[model samples]
Target chain A: MPQREGSPWRGLNVVFFRELFDHLTSVRMLVLEFLVVLFGAAVVYFAAEQIRNTTAEDPFLFLRLFAPPGQSLLSFVVVISILVPIMSIGLGFDAVNGEYNRRTMSRILSQPIYRDALLFGKFLAGLTTLTICLVTLWLLVIGFGLLRLGIPPGAEEIGRLLIFLLVTIAYAGVWLALSLLLSVVFRSTATAALVALGLWLFLSLLWPALAQMLGGVISPPDIRFAQLGLPTPDTLAWQQGLSRLSPGTLYGEAVVAMLNPDAQSMTTLLAQFQGRIGSPLPLDESIVQAWPQIVSLIAGTILLYVVGYVAFQRQEVRA
Target chain B: MTDNVIEASALTKRYGRATAVDGISFTVGRGEIFGLLGPNGAGKTTTILMMLGLTDVTAGTVRVLGHDPVREPLQVKRVVGYLPDTVGFYDYMTAEDNLRYTAALIGIPLADRDKRITSALERVGLQDVGHKHVGAFSRGMRQRLGLAEILMKDVSVAILDEPTSGLDPHATSELLEMIRSLKRDGVAVLLSSHLLERVQSVCDRVALFHSGRIALLGTVPELAREVLGGGYNVEVEADGEGLALRFSEIGGVKAVDQSGPARYRLLADRDVRPQAAAAVVNAGGALRRLSVEEPSLDAIYNHYFETHGGQNAAA
Candidate 1:
């Protein structure tokens, strides 16, 4: 770096640290983290209490805290599915346009750093912040589970939980990259945030409604079966396939199968194999089951991030 | 072995169908204050952006510190620091914090960072207020803070885009003085200002930009002589009733006009201070003041635009 003869990432460290400090101290990030952590911990607490009172034998009891343990009070997975997108968007929706609006874009570009370093650093910094936030909440849940259940998680349980933590981070990264892409595409931070939040609403609330309609067209369960209140297997498969397209659903599927080893399969086909397996599967076996869902989540995150990076690097700084 | 800090040849920049800068060429040498004199939208800022490699050159090439900005932008940026026309910083951070972040961006090592930041603040006269938030700083102070950033980078050249813009007369003068000091420190300074009178006092050489092309390039004196067709406008003052009539008869006097009791304006093709003095003495009147001046830059700019048929007036 002293001679400026290396890759463009030579200035990446400086950009990363500066952005990390900025995100850590910003009022927006602090407020979002507060809401997410408080709500996340509350859900895990209720779920942990519900699992403690279960009469049936559950081998992977600690993992059951993430999936629904009892009543419909919203499991930890459901809370995160609803909240992580908001938190990640809050962290990144102002990444590029905010700098341009403040007249700081030219000044930063004037430094020895290339556009690659700046955009990459910003995305990594935001992702790292998300990772730290998610890990802390995961630890809090484990701690609360230990206190309530009086049973420590075995090594296999810890390994599965660690993978779950990584999957959640990858899931948050997708929203963060999508938000960063919006920030680069829009010139105003308000517009970027609005569009990102609009997309979030579309995925979380409206998409499900639309999916129900599209599911009917893709696999009509036959109007005659509707009178018997029994849908065909085509409708069930299409509905599951449609929901799998959402990152939230991808994350939920991956985590539930990997975390709860007692889950034999992720589809209605589970009824065929339920009586065959009487015990929980090992951590590696469960990961093998969830590998496709995990790969899709990671690939989706990388694709979104690369799109943002390329768009930002191609952007011109007029000043 | 080259003396130039920046050399741009056949530089052109276009946005869509509109060309912002067209086939311009210039060189900024060490310790020289080169000014880009033009009106708003004259492509001065675009040229600077091209030099900094912040924008792609639509055509042509530019070499900064002997490295092509397009291909070796990091090396070029390492040696050249740009202070934008209207600079901004992280308003929530203190001045020191802002400078610290910039130092990191430039790859300044941690061991030398504190000392360098302090000296840079002291150099820009911001040391006393380094702890203050930038949001509360006035426009002029922020401008100086921008300078501090360049100084901290310790670059060989400073490309400032309208550095004196939006400042009061006093602040403008102080900034000019600061730029002068930078030149004394062996730093090549290239600044753009739309006002000729302001840059005339600081620039050693200037390029007059009209419609994205250099209409004229030379020292201030050369431009004055070439554009106004050659001469000195000499004003002579005496306290007699007939001195104006007598002073008009001096040698090499092209035209003469009388203003008051004894004041006469003589447009002389050569230096006529001595001949005019002799005539004023011979008029048997008291001599008070004598002034000689060349044609102003404003006149040269107007003549240039008119001669070019006003093909591309910057509106």
Candidate 2:
């Protein structure tokens, strides 16, 4: 690398604050916030109602608000996994290209700052916005749980919930980075948005099924496991591994581990039945179990951001 | 340290196979208004970008205030202000807010920001509309706002690309006057434009760009002399006995032609208006009109291109 002259972060705070203000006041953000809060409240309310009737003496009742046992299709966690990507994409799909369309890129770049400051500031601003939104939603869900269940969460439950919130932000970071990368790659805002939404749809809705099919082809089930009508361990591992490539899959698995402490590894459900039927695992153990997924979410975010930064640096500032 | 604020030597930019700026060289001194005159795609904007360190230089070196733009971009940018061809601001942002954002980026202290922004806006005659959203601003207003940004930065050099391109004639003259004021403030200005007549009035020196090369470089009169073969054309309209003969006998009058019944076009090495008027009145003739046509940039440009067989001379 050629030795650069000044600090790469010279004007970072300026760009960050300006972009944060824009995101906070934008009508698009208000609409997305309304939708997420509406869906989140409804899902958590239904989950809390169901938990109140079904589980009378469960130790982790507050956790059930996020991943209610009966509703596998639309739990609070599931709603978040699906909508967070959309919200992130909304914040980021036009981040860089909007400047180009407005003809402000050259003027801004001519300031005494590097391109690093601009891209980093935009990413930080988007992530901060996502954090604020998710934290608000988390608190709302907890408050609703307290009203409906009449039980304050244990310190451990709150800890796990906090971890879950961080994991959710990391997941949001993944999609935000991907959309920002698309913005840098495409000059037109419409094209960048379309491609980002298309990618979100593919990863969230179609990639899980595609991964299973591809895994079965790659690692065929053993004859002995097939004769006993049991899924082959190697084949199951391959499918899980392939599916984890999608940020949605990683987020879902991490939330499962965080919210439902009774849940163990994907291939070790028998271990759960052995001696831990009535007891939940400790928060640390749950985190250890979900460590790889958390890392993957965070790594995917950094990888995407690095790619966008490189593309932005190479781009011409003419227009 | 030096009087020159911008200096580029053998500056070149090549996009893959074709050269955009082909080994061009120039220098802009303090308080000087330099014009980069060219047609579209003549590489004027590209050259400006190279100088601001907004684009990479394929070959050659550019220094702004004795700092290399490519290697020391921030140092150069700190002292240089650039107004792009189509300058833009956030449409939803009020003019004051937009200036505030730029002020933060330029690292102006908070204590000084409002005062500087107000004064800069006042300088551009935009103080009254500072609270209005920029989306409602006219093209002339936006161009003025761009200049206000340069003024707020208090930069040593201001590089403007087509500052008055889309403005009406009234706005164009207003912008040109502001450019002249920038010169008066000891700020070097490098402005690029395809309009010759408007730019010629304000530019102290100009480099005519053609196909990525400086086809002509000098003051307007110097260019006119090199290309037009003569300095001044004195038109005298008088009626008397042998009036044309009397005017032709004046010193420095090269040739005289009877253009009309009472008009005589005198080709002169210098302005001969006083002598011609004196001769007409001295000979007891009624001098209808006596005017000197200083060599116009349009004529020099057209004549040079016509003689040189330049096919791309659209401007």
Highest-TM-score candidate: 2
lDDT of 2: 0.91
Which tens-of-lDDT digit does each residue in B41-89 have in candidate 1? 8899999999998888899989998988888888899999899988998
CA deviation > 4 Å runs, candidate 2: A269-279, B240-255, B310-315
> Would you list the C-alpha lDDT of every candidate in the order shown?
0.85, 0.91
Interface RMSD of 2: 0.8
Tens-place lDDT per residue, model 1, A203-312, is: 77777667767888888888777888887767877876787778877887898778767666564355355554656767776887788888988898899889888888
lDDT of 2 by residue, B1-315 (tens): 778898899999999999899999999998999999988899999999999888889998889999988888999899999999989999999999999998899999999999999999999999999999999999999999999999999999999999999999999999999999999999999999998888888999999988898888998878876887665799988888898888789987778999999889997767899999899888889998888987777777778878874555442
Best candidate according to lDDT? 2
The CAPRI category of model 1 is medium
Candidate 1 lDDT (Cα, 0 to 1)? 0.85
Off by over 4 Å in 1: A1-5, A70-73, A218-239, A270-281, B230-232, B240-254, B268-275, B292-294, B307-315
* Residue A235, model 2, lDDT: 91
